[model samples]
Target: MLASGLQQPAHGMEAEENPYLEIVKRNAFDLTNTPTNTQQKAPEPLKANDIKLTGIYLRNGVERAAIALIEKDKKNTKPTYLQLAVGEKQGTVEI
Candidate 1:
């Protein structure tokens, strides 16, 4: 004798009923709802070309990464270094 398999339909969660669904709605967009006169332009996002990987090291057991930002200041010749691990973020860039 052969048995037939049945499939179940996937269900969607409504935001009004579930708090988890509402969390996505809040963070999904970067909407700026400001008055017409007081609104200012958002800062430009950091580009990949502006970043340089300086070093990577392991401490204890976890690994860490360092990066330098390439700025256009003639007086400040030294690169500004940022140390980050895992999900850490510097400015608009995340590691």
Candidate 2:
């Protein structure tokens, strides 16, 4: 029997005589020949704030120890300066 160009040979016929085999073969060929969809491009990076900064301080003297405690209380949230000079103005130190 033949329907829609597909052949179904009699039960005793050889496999090479079946028309359905041709249809299946053609479908397999088309499936392998078809192309896949293209991939999408990646988006560009925007200029945004993504950087972070952290600070840590250690001191041994009594005056430096007091400043370190104050820094701890503030959580060292912002950049700060500490001074230890008694007679002369010393340079600022970042913590």
In candidate 2, position 28 carries an lDDT of 60
* Per-model TM values vs. the true structure: 0.42, 0.20
Model 1 clash pairs are none
- Count of backbone clashes, every candidate in sequence: 0, 2
Give per-residue CA lDDT, model 2, range 1-95, as digits (tens): 44876756557557768777888877865676546867778998653322223333344632321122124345546534443433433333222
C-alpha lDDT values of all predictions: 0.72, 0.45
What lDDT, from 0 to 1, does candidate 1 have?
0.72
Score candidate 2 by TM-score against the native.
0.20
Model 2 ranges off by over 4 Å: 1-13, 33-35, 38-95
Per-residue lDDT, model 1, residue 73, is 47
